[model samples]
Target chain A: MTISVLVVDDSPIARKMIRKALPADWDISIQEAGDGDEALAIYRSGGIDVIFLDLTMPRMDGFTLLEKLQQDDLNCFVIVVSADVQPGARERAMKLGAIEFVPKPIDPQALREVLREYGVMV
Target chain B: MSELLLNDDQTAALQEIANIGMGQAGNSLARIWGEFVALSVPRIATVAAARLPELIQRCVGDGRVSAARLLFHGAMRGEALVVISAADRRTLGSLMGFPAPAGDGDPGAQLLHIAETLAGACLGGIARQFEATIGFGAPALIGEDLPARAVVRADTLGVDLALCLEVRFRVEARSLAAHLVMLMPRQEVQGLAVLLDRFLCTL
Candidate 1:
């Protein structure tokens, strides 16, 4: 089975960058969402194994989405992506049940490490 | 009346801080645009609120000017204004591989958004250096005709010293130009300078 991943961000460019950074031969099926509401809708449809979420977005931020997902007991790995690398942002993401926090301008090597640790890639 | 002026040391320190912040902002922009960005050494200047219009006109010269206003509040309080020329905007967009849109309203909005984002990144870098929380308000776009005096209020915000940096950057191998003006209350500037000096001494 292909590893299904959902990428959530308000910026089309940011999403594009993240998509480009992912390994080409990772057997991954990619999905996209512009905000938290769209992400929730896609999550409910099932078959999603991992989520790459952006912190600053309109119509529902990453933290709210993570909270809702946890409250509802939805089973999916979550990775936060944000431009604001303030002191508490990463810590807050971890506390909210995020598997990892990826700083923006996405680094391909960092993505690979996170994917490997999550068992999404070998 | 002559405007209040900073001495040589104060000016140098302020310029150094601005340069560091601009460098960080350039790095952030490069990351967002998915390309390398290089910035020229920043030029520093200071002007009183009353003389701002003439200063802007002289600074911009014959080039077309676009101004965006953002308010930053935290340990350091004031406005962070970004002004870029039309030619520079095209250069920046090209370097980032983003096509300049044709429509008037859309282009204006996009340019203003970019200015706001740049101001946020630059000011955010400065805030990080100072170990402070910075909040940004919405950006307002202004025309060349608008008086700079009207754009910034002197009494309402309680700014002590206004620090401005003229910045130039190249993206995608094209030169782009802009300015970053940060207004800080006098007390904050003195306090911050002392703290930074102490920190540097310890280092």
Candidate 2:
């Protein structure tokens, strides 16, 4: 099964970097969103398997989106990818319902391990 | 002194570097100041030195701006200018646990302290990214209600163009805000360009 992934960040370069991190050969369909609102729209549209999120954004942040997902009881596999590596940020994101936290610029090896461990990739 | 030319990738990468630095800076202030900080997307560009006063004025929003300037030296060297609205200055002492200003409690001193921590953390954050070491000079406080351009006089830095990074931080709990900008003169911008290239290769 091809994993459907959404890369959400305000920086085009940052989204591009995240794209480079994913295995080129992996069977994955990728979509991009500039902020939480766009990502939420795509999420509501369905078929999104994993969300790589960024914390600080223009309209609705990752933490807010996470809260919304929780409030709606939306089943989500959110992995926060942020430059804000503060300890509090990580704890807050997790409390709101993110499955994993990856610091920027994305470490491909760690991300791969996360994908494999979660069975998103065989 | 030439136009600081940068391609699209270089420009985007520079902004990301500034964003990463801003994140670390926000984390430091939030941890020590006991407030959540909301960061604006950083504005990165190369601007002519002539337009600086106008640019600085726009960032602070009013001439009665309180500012602290610090010089940072490293493989990459530049100056950091942090300006807080006089309106927001009233909240600083209490936020950092400093007592009421008694009479005219060295507001200058207080502003310098905040700038040192905020700007130092930001530069330190950027250094960690480049795997470089940076040392900061003492913080200097500009007078209250001074023009923002007073922070840098034309004859002082002597460069016709500069690489600039500007970011705003909002204190979520108190609704206070600070405008922070970092600038490197012509020579250092060339160095920064090379560093941006190395960062992109890794990406």
True contacts kept of each: 0.00, 0.65
Best-performing candidate as measured by lDDT: 2
- The list of candidate 1 runs beyond 4 A from truth reads A1-122, B1-10, B32-35, B90-105, B144-161, B185-191, B194-203
lDDT of 2 at B21: 86
lDDT of 1 by residue, B1-203 (tens): 44444555555544445545665677666665555554444555655554555555565555566677777777556666676666665455544445556533345565566767678878776666556768888887765434433444555554434545566544544555566666554455555566455434432
Give the true-structure RMSD of model 2.
Answer: 2.6
Candidate 2 achieves a global lDDT of 0.84
Largest TM-score belongs to which candidate? 2
Per-residue error (Å), model 2, residue A90:
3.0
TM-score of each: 0.50, 0.89
Q: Looking at candidate 2, what is the lDDT of residue A75? A: 75
* Candidate 1 per-residue C-alpha lDDT over A4-84 given as tens digits, one digit per residue, 9 for 90 to 100: 999998666567767888998889899999989999999999989999998766678787898889887869899987664
Name the 10 consecutive residues with the lowest summed lDDT in model 2 chain A.
A68-77
RMSD for each of the candidates: 16.9, 2.6
